[model samples]
Target chain A: MNNSSSVIEPKTRPIRKSKIDYSQGPAPVSVNPAWCKACNICVALCPQGVLEPDAEGKPVVAHADNCIQCGACWAHCPDFAITSNYK
Target chain B: MSIAAKEAGARQDSDVVLRYLRPHVKFPNMWCPGCGNGVVATSLIRAIDKLGIPRDNVVLVSGIGCSSRMPVYLDFQALHTTHGRALAFATGVKFSRPDLKVIVITGDGDCLSIGGNHLIHACRRNIDITTILINNYIYGMTGGQTSPTTPAGAHATTTPFGNTEKQFEACDLARGAGASFIARTTVYHTTQMDRLIMEAIQHRGFSLVEVISNCHTYYGRLNRVGQATQLLRMFQEKASTQPKDPNMVDEDSKDMIQTGIIHRDTEKTELCDEYQKLTDSLAKGKSS
Candidate 1:
């Protein structure tokens, strides 16, 4: 309220969010959900960050594009849920 | 005479110069066409070249297998020993002539199935030698029999219903057996294979490099995979790098892992170093 309040404050702007494109993600390899036990062994062994956990802790191929197709996941899996299709 | 004229004359006469170029042993190579044994042999040669060890100071040993014929093709001092005894012979050679660089070339069945005891003891003792295990999944020389490394549920001559026994991971076994330097590479990855073999030879302690090779005639036919290229394609498709956390692996996608160096540790004391230390102390005591 004083007469010395002539200084103006700097304006603060809100940060903008960038749009994400799901189409750019990895292609999904065929998964036999029926055979899956949700053990998540493939999730931990994937060198590429292509897999993620779902709400029930089941493995979900979140980034299939990152898969290099080394058969460690297939060889290590006790149950055969994941199968790769050679393009 | 001008310098260029002298150099040209020397180059022209170089072919006539006496050079000790001879086969280590005669070779009517037993390996089949498109087999990965050639690649493994090339890697071993490149390793020997890089080390620059005198030909007389190196002894190449091999057991009976398709890949075992490597020593026959090399120019170094060599021994084509009995089946499943290459490691045992190599151990004797290393201990007897500690000055020599000893190398053992063997296949999956030859090394893991029969020579496994020798291999474990060699690793346990940490002998100053390099061992290359060419894992081709089937016993190629013996008509496609099941090997210790044949994948579970995979067909073999002995296991027509598919192999029920679990396959042994060679690198893991070597690591567990106390091999100082352990690496795994496939024949398809020649660049990495050459580099890894060279590094293994240069390493002071016991080193083991598991070379996953293809046995087209036997293993391929038994497995219903027609050709070497198909098997190589499978390797390219199935192998992947190790994950950051083994626990974060997907349950569904368990077949994709790449081929590369899996483990390497340079800090451990070599077996020969320990032996020297013990001998030195004993000599000091005796002198006193």
Candidate 2:
């Protein structure tokens, strides 16, 4: 029991999660072409196949309905090109 | 609400990370398309934003390497110093101005090899500086040379047959050197990376967060790993959340690296604070 006092505890955070209200339907996913280098990472990582690569390997929002707005693509985009509308 | 108000609301949702970047730092950055450095930089910006630290009060110092190029893209008081001396320069900055938060961004070769002495002494001094050592295992900038942290069986340009030396566990090295706080997380663990960086910054003494990033352009191609996505998936599969003894030679978790805080000691004295006390006592004795 002496070790109990020394054990580190994970900090508690506010329970609120996700800025997008899912009840309002799926949010829009936009890709900024200027910043995008056509890495195909967002297309490969989209869990629902919401994004598809066009002729030049650039990611295009092909199936917006499939987007759960889980932010996997948003968080993994190496170029910071993808953004899920939080408003 | 009118369509105009809705459009305004949507525009604001573009990207919260852009507010932290300099307006003129070019698009797409200098790293390879799927390099993990970009992802690490994004997490860092988000962490800084969450802390609400004023941009002017933060200083970013770096030494020459792919990871050291971070200061060029990030909008902060930046200094791109010589190779392997980022921590030395950062220590000077902390001593002169104790009010600012100094962060050092370095790579595997820069921190563990040439800068090895500085790393140990900085940890020993326990100064209030946060170091983010991005360990991608190989020297990506110099064409995939095997670094000190590269695994024994891993292949690099310098060691095509296979690296024969045992890897340096960076977190254990920091702990042994007397760092007050130490944490490790991969680029695959974005949320954990953000939380650990925030915690490391808030810690009162010397804090080290070794970020295991992907150098897909060099490390991945040399090792026959598919791409950045595949490398990230490998990290997700290989890393364990539980803490393990670095010294132990466990067979079950031999391939796994621990994520989360590895060690912490808050009672250790910070160098600058102790120096201030010494100066105060000296002045009082002179007056008496």
Candidate 3:
């Protein structure tokens, strides 16, 4: 009986590279800074460490290159200040 | 770093194939030119790559649909089962071989409409499987027919007059049914799709990814978003963040609904975990 339990391996190995041009710097996250109340939710929740606090404690893109464009920061931001350019 | 050194590094890395791939599976999938299933398939493969989960330890299961062809293309232990029974089959597979990572690729019609019972029970039981529901909003394989996730007033073979029934939000339904991880992403956002799939796979209990895909051949033509590019553009524009209150409307949004991971809770016990506990208790009682 060919038990459906046989283990199979991936036929091809994929290369590790960012699909987007990260060298071009962080893609700008469209934000209305004025609407941002510095809740810091974006900074705290960002898994990629993309956001950082400015001198006024406002969230800014500290490491845009690392942003995987997961949208977690944008989704969690209460103020609706963050958006991304999928284009 | 020097420019020459950087260029050399890039060249070296570019040629190296992913270590996780099985090497026997060939490229150039069977999906049509504009089918979004290819994109979703790539994202799943990429997620598998990122996690470095041994290909031998993962099992891909699917039902009848364009997306269901995913298992055939990927070099893995795949079960292309009957229409609307992928979850049921996957449940059996996971319970029997707990060591293997099981993933279910189902279409809206195949899953929600026909396999709704299995989907509901899978969530309620908190099965340890990752389900990627590719919702192109219509039955692409059997011509353009209305699906459970087809937006209200959308055109389809059966709903040429414009569908009047409400759509099923798969992620919301999964969350309501007690799924541990629920995420929603579109084919336009490939990077986010990859991240979400990786996270969902790592989650302990049942994980659902309601991937809004584009069916340019049928669904797009019927919906008036004719071209693949147009459908992708529309998804980018209309899809917004899930609001804190499900009822809260986005004032600037043209469409009332939102996208992105709507809900995720990891504290719940998985079906396998609970089952093990029950068996252990029974054994202890018998011994005592």
Best by lDDT: 2
What's candidate 2's DockQ score?
0.24
Superposed model 2: Cα runs more than 4 Å off:
A1-27, B1-14, B245-252
Q: Scoring each candidate complex against the real one, what DockQ results?
A: 0.01, 0.24, 0.02
lDDT of 1 at B50: 55
Q: Which ten-residue region of model 2 chain B has the weakest summed lDDT?
A: B5-14
Query: lDDT scores for all predictions?
Result: 0.69, 0.83, 0.74
Q: Model 3's CAPRI class?
A: incorrect
DockQ category of candidate 2: acceptable
Expressed as tens digits, the lDDT of each residue in B1-288 for candidate 3 is 554455454432211123333456653444554467766765777688768888889899999988898777677789999999999999999999988999999999999999999999999999899999999999999999888988888999899899999988787788888998888888777778889999999999999998888887788888877555466657877777756454656654535346667778778888888888999999999999
Clashes of 1: 30
Clashes of 2: 0
Superposed model 3: Cα runs more than 4 Å off: A1-87, B1-27, B244-257
True contacts kept of each: 0.00, 0.51, 0.00
Top candidate on DockQ is 2
In order, how many clashes per candidate?
A: 30, 0, 10
The most accurate candidate by TM-score is 2
Model 1, residue B18: displacement in angstroms? 17
lDDT assessment of candidate 3? 0.74
Interface RMSD of 3: 17.7
